[model samples]
Target chain A: METLDGYLDMDLLRFTTAGSVDDGKSTLIGRLMFDTKTIFEDQLESIERTSRQRGDENVNLALLTDGLRSEREQGITIDVAYRYFATPKRKFIIADTPGHIQYTRNMVTGASTANLAIILVDARKGVIEQTCRHSFIASLLRIEHVVLCVNKMDLVDYAQERFEEIVAAFKAFATRLQIKEITFVPISALHGDNVVNRSANMPWYEGPSLLYHLENVYIGPDSNHVDARFPVQWVIRPHSREHHDYRGYAGRVHGGVFRAGDEVVVLPSGFTTRIRSVERFEGPVEEAFSPMSVVIRLEDDIDVSRGDMIAKPNNQPRVEQELDAMFCWFSPERPLEPGRKYLLRHTTRSVRALVREVRYKVDINTLHKEEGDVQLGLNDIGRIHVRTAEPLLYDSYRRNRLTGGFVLVDEGTNRTVGAGMIR
Target chain B: MTQSYQLSHLDQLESEGIFVLRETAAQFERPCILFSGGKDSIVVARLAQKAFWPARPPLTFLHVDTGHNFPETIEFRDRFLGDLGAQLQVALVQDSIDRGRVVEEKGPNASRNGLQTVTLLDALEEGRFDAAVGGARRDEEKARAKERFFSHRDEFGQWDPKNQRPELWNLFNGRKQTGEHFRVFPLSNWTEMDVWQYILREEIPIPALYFAHEREVIEREGVLLAVTEFLTLREEERTERRTVRFRTVGDATCTGAVESAASTLEAVIEEVASARQTERGGRADDRRSEAAMEDRKRQGYF
Candidate 1:
């Protein structure tokens, strides 16, 4: 039996994939899972049966990811589907999203929590308009790492010049975006070249395979640790007999390090106190950091409830009623217009907000701003000014994604209409 | 005072599960955790305990009993709930059958797994529960791969796979009409291997059916099924005593067992890690058709 130590110590990495209709995105994901031996024998049999029934010559690897019946029948992905696989080094979560123009909202949803993105570019077509649009979305969502997979290299005869030309063209266009790290790889996902193992076909290429890069990428510094931010989600006040007057603030630490005896301030109320203890289910800990859920007990009693934020007194978030942000409209039926009221939810707080003005709309394909189109329809990206009924504690989205992001809800239909990032 | 800031995969998954549980408590007026005495639900129940430590979770435990469950599972469920000091509401398939709410399938291959959906929906309506927290993981099946953490259901308790709301970041939209409810899955990101590893790490108690044991069984269509009164045997089918363990717990008629000697938690984890077949591969319900799970989920099956 294999030891459980390696499995227990493995970390996690979440990445998103983007490609056009014919870029073979599903095939790429399937290849990664298959070559790693993560695909079970039963699943392979099922896919093989389906492929034979569809009268395909070879086993269609894409059949593994197209889960929904509609997707299988129409040969298109309709929404986001999550897939999982693990190696000895790390566990991976793939947010496989559709690549159609109208499915921009789905891609945004997938990219919101991802640390990296894999954008597939067909070798025959080189970089096209769809490539630019996918890259822009990745930058807009603040994904730090990107792997540009030039797929179907077998079709291009594994030529070194063609791969270099595509890389150069993509690099020139990428200068406009704020992507911090970019790695270019040439692979043929259909024949399983350069996905999991070194390909003998492409002897000129000298780099780690796609899976190797994913397992070794430095995502430890991806989370913000300079500023402390915690949005209280619940108040745990057990009315049991053993302990009375036990009030603790329950939340997941958004950023920075929090320890016992540290001075902190509660937002909106402006009450300051010292942290008495930082406790998890096991016991009290010395310190807690980003993404760890724990209960914090303060030295003094104060009015802290749901939707309240706790942060260090020295480093506090911006408290303002009027704010500027970029909005991605999600509702297909309605367009965002000035002077309209909606419910804006930020952190844990929700309040009424009005759209004051539309500054400009971004043409994602060309990376150009159209100042004349003031209204944002479905899948349109634009900057707008919003005035809330209550002041919000936030930071610029470029600094902290957890504190600076929000969703707008339409009251009438009770549907999430838009997502915003603080500017 | 110096430590790596990064969390291990298990710790991250635990934190995410706890966060979702807390969100469920704060957002909905009334919620319940669907307990099946299976490893997945057992892990969920433990997370709920940690999520609201020093206090019993405000949510109740609801079990949709199919009357075809293994006796060991039902016994485990009762004892576990007694220890947790939480409330439990059992919706019985037998009661639904008595009321003619649902009809039982007849033949050599009859099972009440499909009948549990109607009883579950009826119980949710009667209890007026706004959220039903389930222990479903996306990696368990193909159709479940697209499920959201906060899955919305209409008033009729039907799921629309086509028109789902876009879930972004940690923000979940729980707003709904009066009669409509939601199916919240805290374990949507967990894989089968993760579930077993968590159970081993936390020392959570589960039904003995998960460990190797001797029981009367019959081999049908390459699946080792427990020989219970709920199952009707054919002329050629013969029962034999075998040492086996179950990978998943469900209706006795559908859940299958595998031959194994891993009787301890460590042994089970080792078995799961090295196992080549998917956990649900042994389930007979999923073998009905290519879209069996999707079709059942659309009609409000858990």
Candidate 2:
């Protein structure tokens, strides 16, 4: 394998930036990109021209990320805007999600793929409802790291007590959520303090700056490397004159380590086979690991198609018909209707599913469970039981986010109505 | 370091995109790709080519011709498809203006950039394409950054940013009702640097306009605009010959260039490395407002 020095050596970290509409999330992202010299000359010129036209004193750094016309006019984010930046230390993908309550589903989408989530809180408006809501959604999505960025410290005269007060309030609230890691930093995104570089204003605070934390945060061991699972996406056969008998199970490895001669079992069918070869785009590799896309040719060709799981013969997932899991309802037109048929997509496999029951609705603000409502509205998180027509190979979402998660599609409309994480 | 036990960033992104493309093809009865002759769409095109290899690309490429594109991009598009033997469908904006589907702006420097959406929607309706593959990366714009990989458009081809489908894991929901279409972005996960790096590594052929060259240009809104027929300089507006190149290509009227001396791809790569503004910052259409791209996207402008 070839590794380039400057760009390739820096690890990639995906982090979502969440804040109330006025908490300066966009400006912070803009500052990061600008300080890192990621912005091009044309973009800077456009921002300057637009700033002069808008009659603003200084170029609105937030305008760099304010991509939608409505969002700029309204001065509020309505969706998740993803921004990317790279420093010498690491590459970053920032999912800039909206702070409004209605856009909680967007936060879920962003957090679903993020390694860390930056929850922004205005220094003046310390620990508001949207802050809790964003944190709850982060925890619900199982995002591992949470960085509480207390932005607009300049508004508070760069006082350490104000930052401490906000941090205490957040820590108290976060205690209820099931988050593994949390960090707090005071920042002024507009003035570029404590974002990319260490701030001299808060001499009392000794922790690293926001950029340093993002760069050095441990995310390399996030994937499940112990339990081997492969959900076959396609059967690759070049099918030409030269390579006639090529049969490769092409899929992204969801967990654990897979070797050339590892004994494997095909799910649902439970047919056993030994992996003959592990191939990537370059050539046949000696070994394949979790999250890598490799085509595996089995010694014996059993009935394997898209959606079928292939794992170690001894470390197989439980094949089950009933699933009890947490789900975030995504559709506005339709609430989750019990006893209705919906397509349940897990990995690459889609199966007909019946929503048997709605266990309870979770309150984002108070962390309380509301019982007996039996209705799951848009952005509503609830526990439900579902029965699939065919058995699904799965693990607990806590164990593996890749295989344990699934999305529910409305059978009639074919719209994705909800996202479920297996229990 | 022990070999990282995970998919490379690009491969992980590619696998997810391929899965989405396949899901879109399997779920939608009629699907097409919105080919803009850009790197983002080109990546999507390549992914489609690889997605269903041995078999021809399952869908057709839909190009909305503003008739103001660089001759090189159009030529590159035709040749690339010819090499793949893939089908190409052209929807002319001038035809839409002639048929009264959309009105052409009237001014010394009026552009058909915004009106192309009407032509594109008309083409989609005419072809009954339920899903249109687009090269829109979320990193381009703020509202776009919030956009899902599978963006659902209403019957009138309007994007509802407030209401989007929840995309979790690698499982993308491409399922939409009749009369509604989806804009699927396989390169949603890629950054601008990543795109350039991939192009450099794969040795992908791009339009010649990307490399810097000296041209008759005028400075407008702080950007060097190529002096073309679509552009009419006022008596006060001065034209000067400057070495410039385009980061993004669109309707020749709206797209602007920056003064650059990077004549080779490697030099251009280094130039991109030190830049501090976004590539879209040069385009006049997005310069209209902060969220210009988002508004255009909501209006079904690809």
Candidate 3:
């Protein structure tokens, strides 16, 4: 048996895969899990049975990921399906989404929380419009890392020149994107080349396998640790006889480091106080950082409540009634028009907002901004101006995902109509 | 001083779970945790305690007892709740059957697994719970892989899998119309191995059935089942004593045990790490059909 200590301390990585229906995205995931021995026998057997029922030539690996009955029947993924696997080094969560032009909303949803993206490119097709669009979405979501997986090397004779041509074309288009790091890997998902194991066929290509790169990627600098930000989700007041006056503000740290003695300011009210302590279930901790859920006790409680943000006094988020943001329209029923009202939910705070203006809609294929066509319809990405009824305490979405991202809910239907990133 | 900002996988999962728990508490007027005395629910219970430390969780635990439960699991559940000093409301499948809300299956392979859904939905309606928090993980089944963090149910308590609202980032939408409710799963990202490793790291206590023990069992359709009063045997079937442990805890009729001598948590973790079959492989309930889980989930099954 392996040492339980090593398994307990491993970190986590979340990445999304984007590819056209024929780009073999599902097969690639299947190969990764298969080679890593993560796919259990029962799951494999079920898929194999499915493969036989469908009368496919080979055991269709795509059957493993197309989970829904509709997806299986149509042989296409219509929504985002999350898949999980683990290596000795780290655990991984794959947000698998389809790559159809109509499913852009699903891709955006998948990329929202992803640290990295794997954009698969068919070796024969080189960098197509789908490649550019996937890369653009990854960049728009502020994903730091991207892996340009050149799939189906076997079909192209594992040619180094074909792989280079695709990589060169992708790099040319990616220069227009805001992605930080880009890596290229040549693989054949059907034949399992350089997925989990190094492919002997691609001897000229030198790089870590896809699985190795994923397990070893440096995501340490991904989170913001310079500006302390905590949005209170709930307050715990025991009010019991044993601890009558326990007032604990519970929240997950969005950014920076917070210590017991740090001076903090409450948003919207502008009240200042000192942190008495940061307590988890185990007890009080010396410090807390991004993503850790803790209860913070303030030296002076001045009516801090839900939707209120607690941050360091020295550096605080901007307090604004109007927001400049990039909006991705999700509702197919309605187009975003100026002067329309929406319930803007950001960082636990929900406020009524109006669409002040539609600046421009970006053509996802060409990355061109169309100022004349300001009507943002379904699956359209555009820059819009919004004015809220009350002031919002927020940071640029590029600076912090937790504090800057929001969703627009249509009050009539009570559905999430759109998602936005503050500029 | 420079410090590492990285959190271990367990720490990250725990934080995410706590965040979801807090969100559920703050979003809904009345929320309840669906505790089943299983390992996953046990872990959720522990996370709930930590989420509202020093103060008890504002939500009550609702266990929809199938009436075909392991005696050990019931004892464990009661003791665990007593230690936490939390409130529990049990909705019995027997009550649903007696009240004519649901009918019990009969025959040699009869199980109350399907009957639990009606009882559960009835309980939720009776309690007027706006949100039902569960320990269901996506990695467990194909249908669960597509589940949202806050799964919305319509007025009829049916899940519209094709038309689910898109969930993005850390923001979850819990808004719903009256007579509708949501099923919140905080452990959606946790795999079976992650849960076991977490149990070991946190030293969370689980039922003894999870550890290998000598119990009388009967072999049916190549699966080992505990010999209990709820399980009816045919003339051809015979009971034998075997050392086995359960991977998952559900109704005694449907939940099957694997042959093993792994009594310690460490041994169980080791067994899980090297186990080839999925944890749900022995579960007869899921083996009913290809889309059995999806079908059940649409009808308000947890």
Candidate 4:
């Protein structure tokens, strides 16, 4: 997918940013876009005009990210805002999550698909509960790369000791969570230091700039490539003139790889088959790997449809009626009741699940497991057990995020009440 | 040659989009691609074709005709749909006005852009569609940037951005109440440059209007407006021939043309790569207010 003129196709890096309102999350993103010269003139003009109308001394860079009228009117970010920019080295997609107690669900949503998470720490305030909260969520979502941006360093006189103290505190909390790699950078987002370019004030800092690190970070190993999981989304049956009876199971390869003539077993049915072809829009490929959406044609008509999982025979997922998972309740009205029935949607499949038992809830601020509080309310993280009507095929959330994650929908209300990570 | 294990940016985007399209078909009972015959929607139509491949898209295309669209786009839409042998369901704004369901605004800047929501909602209700897939990218506007791949709408077809379902990973939550439907955007992550780059790489045919040519246009509110049949020139405005092309296609009165000499896909890509303003920056409809698009989307405008 390259042009004839030798246009280099850059690899994608999807990352999420989390910070409280006015913690410089939007400012950092705005600086990234601005320094990279990705901002179009018209957009800048509009933002400038709006800034002038608002009577700001300098053009507000935060206005670049607070896009919605309501958010701009209030001068704060409410929902998860997505921003895109590219350097010559790599392309980036930033899922900007708001840092509020009620916006925990949004943080989960934004970091769900991100390979990296940027947890912004204010140099003035140091490591607060919100910092620990963000880091815990990032690690919970399995984001391997965490960059602790100690922002507003100019206010602290660009102190290296201050940066190290916060870094040390973060590592101490991160020890309780599963975080693979952590990087520390001191940045003055408003003054443009150590974000895209090296800062003159912080002469002792030797690590790569934020942009440099983002562009060079190895994200290829971020996904789980050992397990082969293709949750069949749609069965492409194109009974046409040229290609009649084309039954291709269309899905994204969430894990591992699939090749032509590979042995695969369709889940729930327990029917084994060989792949006839791994076809993409370009043409038939020799093999297809994780995240590539392709139509897998089977050698036999084994009666597979949506909600079915196609996997390698050797490495199959656990299939059972009863399951245990760490669930994050997302609804404000109702608590996670043991007797409640929910539509447990996993990958492409959804089944009626009954809460069999209530587990202890988590006190995020203190990182303690509260035994008595079995009730899971809005933004509450707790372990729970459930038995679904139909068998669910899943892997551990620690092993794979795509196949292991699910959302619970209330049967009557149809609202997504909870997000679960299979245990 | 052995296949490389990595996918290009365009390939990744294509795959993600295809996955979204398939998910809609699998989850919802009835879904339609909201086609406006614009470049973005045309790419969406092509992606829909690729998603099913040997089969047709398996979904009807709901084109909410503003009755103020470019004739060229309509012609392109007919030809493209005809080639695919896909079903076309047109929801006309003229019908909405005739039935007194929506009133046409009066003024020199009066455009049916905002009124298209009524017709689109009526069409969705009439068709009993649970999903209306669109080509809106997050990079296009601020409000749309926060929109989910599976955006839930209330029974009145209103979008509550504050109360959206948390869309996690590729698993989209399409469950809704009896009358509520979802507006799905597969291209939420794609940028304008990515779209052009994809169009160039795939060599997909786009409308000639995307390329610059001599056109009768008038400058209004610091943006260029093409002289279409629906357009009424202001007393101070005068139409002139300029080498310009459209960054987007919508109601002829609202969508503006940009000054360029681009004529080919490669040329358009190059121009887009270096362009200063966003595709929607010149759009009069989006310029009505900072939250105009947000307000329209809340009311079910595509």
Task: Assign candidate 2 its CAPRI class.
Answer: acceptable
lDDT of 4 by residue, B142-179 (tens): 78888899999999999998668778877788888799
3 versus 4: better lDDT goes to: 3
lDDT of 3 at A103: 89
DockQ, prediction 4: 0.72
Comparison by DockQ, 3 against 4, better one: 3
Query: How much is the lDDT of residue B229 in candidate 1?
Result: 90
C-alpha-based local distance difference test score of model 4: 0.87
Q: If you assessed candidate 3 against the hidden native complex, which CAPRI class would it receive?
A: high
lDDT of model 4 at residue B71? 78
Give candidate 2's TM-score: 0.88
Candidate 3: what lDDT? 0.92
In the range B112-211, model 3's lDDT, one tens digit per residue, is: 9999889999999999999999999999999999899999999888999865788887798899999999999999999999899899888889999999
List the lowest-lDDT window of 10 residues for candidate 2 chain B.
B1-10
Candidate 2 or 1, higher DockQ: 1
Which residue runs does candidate 4 get wrong by more than 4 Å?
A1-8, B1-4
Tens-place lDDT per residue, model 4, A1-423, is 244334446678999999987788888998999999889887788879988999988878888988777777776777788899977677789999898878888898898889999999999899999998898889888999999999999999999999888889888888998988999999999989999889999999999899899999887655577899999988887677678877889999988889998999999899998999999777997777877888999999889988999999999999999899888889889788998888989988989999987778877767789886479888888899999999999999999998889889987777788888888
Which pairs, if any, clash in model 1? none
lDDT for each residue of candidate 3 in A1-423, tens digit (9 for 90 to 100): 457888888889999998868999999998888878889998888889878988999988877888878778887888899999998898999999999888899999999989999999998888999998999999999999999999999999999999998888888998898988999999999999999888999999889989989999898655799989999999999889997999999999999998998999999899999999999989998889988999999999589999999998899999999999998999988898789999999988989999989999999999999996478999999999999999999999999987889999999888899899999
**RMSD value for candidate 2:** 3.6
Chain B alone, TM-score of each model?
A: 0.98, 0.95, 0.98, 0.97
In model 2, the runs with Cα more than 4 Å from the true position are A1-5, A22-27, A38-64, A100-102, A121-132, A152-176, A237-239, A243-247, A372-374, B6-8, B52-56, B92-107, B110-115, B216-241, B287-295
